[model samples]
Target: MPGWEDRARIGWGPGAAPTTTVQVEACPAASAPAAWSVYTGGTWVASPACVPLVIRSEGQQVEVRLAIGAACGENN
Candidate 1:
């Protein structure tokens, strides 16, 4: 924990300029979301809306949840 302070970064707060103006899509995109590493802060990024993808295979229904949006990781 010696270098914790040096490694820490602050994120944007709610209602802040960065947080207040992210326009999310009314409908999520059909494409899958990409994986990003742990945020290092300095910027607000939530876009390319994504939705749950359900796959029905062999009488089994599997839901694939991908965190594409920074808001809650999903459109809904």
Candidate 2:
């Protein structure tokens, strides 16, 4: 599937622009006991990566996939 990931990725919250930086946690809420991510480590992003997040409440959980990547910008 060429665009399978594109179709699978889940996103929400304020629209964000990507940047290659080894800083910023992927999802802060996921770190809490209420939520978690299937993909672990690499809190900071320097390249394209995929993260599957699970949020739980009242014995139920919703799964979402996050796609993080580099944003194009000036070469300089």
Candidate 3:
């Protein structure tokens, strides 16, 4: 079995710092390989790779979830 990496880019609009959540799901057949990424507020906040949940055969599904904290307040 081989390993690979993938990249994803996201963007945000002008406004106060806001919290966001991202979820990625991959379903592949025939012993395939895949990866995922999550971005928030135009920044690459988190990326986890080689999740064990990946199924190499059939009816395999991979799900990635992210919960972002609100940006620090100006008073901080």
Candidate 4:
């Protein structure tokens, strides 16, 4: 393994933010709970808020679990 050097530049271009896929589940009314909320950090808030959910940095990959119920008068 002499004179074997790994040389390469790896990164995104300008205006390119790191992309990652998030897993979200839209439960059916039958399977949805009567009323549920999500446990964010230390406090629990109303699930399925219109605002975007923020995730904490851990490593290259992470998994988040959120329990959301059905909307008012909506099935699934």
Tally clashing residue pairs in candidate 1. 0
- For model 2, the stretches where C-alpha displacement exceeds 4 angstroms are 1-43, 70-76
- Return the TM-score for each candidate structure: 0.26, 0.30, 0.18, 0.19
Question: Candidates 2 and 3: which is better by TM-score?
Answer: 2
Measured with C-alpha atoms, the lDDT of residue 55 in candidate 4 is 46
Q: Which tens-of-lDDT digit does each residue in 1-76 have in candidate 1? A: 1222232222433433432222222333447575443323233323333334354555776765434442344355
Candidate 3 lDDT (Cα, whole model)? 0.35
Instruction: Give residue 76's error in model 3 in angstroms.
Output: 16
Candidate 3 has a TM-score of: 0.18
State the C-alpha lDDT per candidate: 0.37, 0.43, 0.35, 0.32
- Return whichever of 1 and 2 wins on TM-score: 2
Q: How far out, in Å, is residue 5 in model 3? A: 28
lDDT of 3 by residue, 1-76 (tens): 1121223223344442423322334445546666443333543334532221232335565643332333333332
Instruction: Tell me the tens digit of each residue's lDDT in model 4 across 1-76.
Output: 1111122111233433323323334434776767764422222233442222334443444433333332432221
Clashes of 4: 0
Q: After superposition, how far is residue 13 of candidate 4 from its true place, in Å?
A: 29
Instruction: Please report the TM-score between candidate 2 and the true structure.
Output: 0.30
- Off-target runs (Cα >4 Å) in candidate 1 are 1-47, 69-76
The per-candidate count of clashes, in order, stands at 0, 0, 0, 0
